[model samples]
Target chain A: MIEAHSISFRYHEAWVLQEVSFRVEKGEFVGVIGPNGSGKTTLLKLLYGLLAPQRGEILFELVPMKKMDRRDIAKRIAVVAQETQLLFPFSVLETVLMGRSPYLGRLLFESEKDLEIARKAMEWTKILPFSERPVEELSGGERKRVFIARALAQEPEVILLDEPTANLDIEHQIDFLDLILTLNRERGLTIVMASHDMNIASEFCDRLILLQEGRIYQMGTPEEVVTKENIESVYGCEVWIDQHPVSGMPRISLLRKGGR
Target chain B: MKIITLKKVLTISILLGFVLIVIILISITMGSVKVPPLRSIRILFRAILGLKGAGNETERTIILSLRLPRAILAGFVGAGLSVSGATFQALLRNPLADPYILGVSSGAAVGAIIAILLGLGVSSFGLPLVSFLGALLSIVVVFYCGRQEGRIHPHTLLLAGVIVGSFLSALIMFFISLSQKEELRTIIFWLMGDFSFSNARSILIIFPYILLGVFLLYLRARHLNLILSGEESAVQLGVDVERLKLVSYLSASLITAASVSVCGLIGFVGLIIPHSVRLIFGPDHRLLIPASALIGASFLVACDTFARTLLAPVELPVGVVTAAFGGPFFIYLLRTRKAIRTL
Candidate 1:
């Protein structure tokens, strides 16, 4: 559970986030969607306490974010960033084991239980076989899965991801979403993700937060907020919105705007 | 540090062991005086088993007086440089990172150069003391310039390191130009790296700082591993990324400064040794860091031995010997291992 109140952020003269506020309920899967430079990442950073708001405060489970140590915050939340460029060539297992660092004591090595947790996390993420291979050698999809395993290793109640599916292939994308959806339902983890793929967010998210120029433009069920008129108004585009035949979720298609 | 099942414990141990033996033998056999190979071996065996021996008083003199301390100094220098290089590479997460890349070497160089200019070498250990002071000042200066919002931005730190290092090097060169020609020769040899005067005093002088640095780094081995995942992820993993960074820069620079003050400039042991260890063993800092220390000490001991004996009576500077081998060997590695997968 987390909340942001009237957060405003500016970089130099440019405003990145303006008076943004939102609450993520426990066990909620909230998908944040917007075009590039819509302040999605800035909001995420603010929520994670990586940045302090220029205007307002972020509360993590009712505590002022600034009051908690970064390590203490890590025990409750895990983040999987878009890219992991480690110049030190670590093996996949080594990467996953790092997830246990938050819970480890100073000077204490990873214990049997810690290693077991890492192993289980790797198994669930299906990267157990590549345990000893360097992370840099991983395919994009495999590396993504490895990072997901690392987050899972944290055993956090809330997992925040910045574009878990951006570079994935369609097949891997389906696989990734299914895995995340499984984690949400079975583990009851809170999932907050920012994605550019509106269709995936519409299909997978329980609720969607649509952002436009650093402010919350719309927030509702996919069917309630993904109307063609709402989308065109926010995204400046025309689209065909229809139901997915199998999942019965709203699936959108772009119909070129102001056709020549 | 979790010892992964795939951890090659035996291989690392074997490599360390093999290097130790070679280094010991090399150090004893070669020095300013060319004792017969057999006599050197005899002296080595006696020293190891604590056996008493006779007439080799001069040989005994060479063993205790000249070779042993120099060998120890060489090992310490190697270990320090290698570990420093490994730490820098991890902190920067750049393959090109080395101990000197942060300007610690140039800072120390400038410090030592100023000592020479001020004629501080007249004191038995004044040069090392002044050089250490110089190094500390450079780190303080670099620290001030590198800080932003209570943290060092990696890019800004790297760039500032280069700028500061070059500036200090320029100052060192300026002083070298103004020095009397006789002092210049001595300064030049010292800059090229030598262990000719290494003794218990020099070792004892810098030991606390070097060991302190090594200790500080050792405690954060796991944190450094996480840092390579990028600072943001490192923070998410519970490392005090900002605080730890300052510690990293300060501790690393302290060791670099101290070691350089006492031993002068050694080349490439830092870059080549760490990368080589990484290539053989994966980049787990737990393994890589200790491995860097052990292997680095042995590597430098061997090189220092080679430098002393390669031309006999007139010894080559250890820096020249190390650089000669390290530079060409590095290029060879690049050519042969160019396509070696990093992922």
Candidate 2:
């Protein structure tokens, strides 16, 4: 479990995140939903200790993140960030093996155990067939799976994802979310995913946190947070809300100003 | 598709090591007085084993005193510059980054010029020591200027290097304008890079710095590979990005300084050797770093051989020879292969 006690962060004069506080329980699949510039990415970064909060603190299992070394923090939390550029020609296996860096000693290379773990992760993500291919040659969806496999290789208690499905098509998006959901259920993994897709978040997440202007606007079940009024108020857009046909979860659809 | 295992790295190292030894022997044999390859090998073995009376005295002197030291010096300079170039490319995330990209060479040139103007004998340690200090000073200034919010921004660091390099180059030009006629030739030759003045002492002086720098960089090979993914990703993967940047910058700078101090500014070896190595081997730093060191040594020794022998009584600057050969070969590689673009 992770806890944030009124954490705030800023770069220069603008506060990117302010007075934000939340806790994620073990094996929880939480989705953070927001419009553009709503500090969703910053929140994920804070949770993983990539950027320390300017005020207050984040704790992992009741221990303040500030006290943890980067390697220690990495062992417990993995992040699949948006826009990881493959500038070099690293193989899919090689990229995934990087997740074991926290466990590797300074002078030691990756052991056979480490390779086995990486291969197993690749198998779970269904990228084992292309383990020898270069990452730069993979499609966007395949690359996302590669990243997820890398995150799995870390064997972390929690995984943070930022806009994981942004550029992915609908099928790939659903496929990605389903894979993550399976991991949460079968492996007892914790997930905190930041996304702008309301319907996807509503369909998949157990709970949702809606953010606006660097503050949490609402936090509850999808039915409680995905209402039309809340969307209009925060996003300044008219919208229609209903239940998903299959899952019976709250679903959101955009409406034109004078058409609906 | 190819991941570099330790066994693969050792194999490639042995192959390249043999290549380097072959180049050194060939270089020793092909100089002004042509000692046969067998004789050169025997003389080198005798010198290494500290044996005597197996070869002619003059041939022994040529192999041990003059040509041997020069070839060794070229090797160190080649290895140092190429390793530094590879490190800089990784640190800056730019394939074009060379050993001189950070203005270290220009700073060293300024130091060497100052020593020459003061009439410091080239045979003394004063010139190289001063140049090394000058290089260190430039690294500090560039690092200071490149930091943003206590982290090194690659773009800013690169810009700072360019600005500092140009400024120091201007100072060099000013010094050249004010120098006496004889001093001008000395300064110009040093700036263009020369190995004619190399001896046993110069080789010994630069060996420790190059070895230390290369070893430090090799230890961080995995971290450097992680960093090529992007700084934020590297941090999330448990790499202390700032500390890695600092260490890489300092280590690479140390090697560049040591090389420039001894042999002036050898161009193209640093710029081209890493790319060639990366093309032949994959971009894994463990293999790339050592491979670059060995291949670079051979390339430079070969170039220096051509520099001294092509015109025989009239010597060309080793820098000129490196650029002359390296530029065309690099262009050919770029045109013929798509792999360099991945860099």
Q: Identify the leading candidate in terms of TM-score.
A: 2
lDDT of 2 by residue, B1-343 (tens): 3466888889999999999988988888877787787888899898788887457989888888888899989999999999999999998889889999999999999999999899887767888888888888898899899998888889999999999999999999999999999999888889989886456899888999999999999999999999999998988888888999988998999899989998899999998999988776778898999999999999999999999999996888899999999999988886865665444
Maximum-DockQ candidate: 2
Q: Candidate 1, after superposition: displacement of residue B65 in Å?
A: 2.2
Per-candidate TM-scores read: 0.93, 0.97
DockQ for each candidate? 0.56, 0.70
Off by over 4 Å in 1: B1-18, B36-57, B331-343
Tens digit per residue, CA lDDT, model 2, A1-260: 89999988997799988899898999999999989999999899889888899898998999999999999988889999998978778889999999998888484368788899999999999999999888999999999999999998888999999989999998999899999999999999999999988888988899999999999999999999999889999999888898898999998887787893
User: What TM-score would you report for chain A in candidate 1?
Assistant: 0.96
Structure candidate 2, residue pairs in collision: none
Docking class of 1: medium
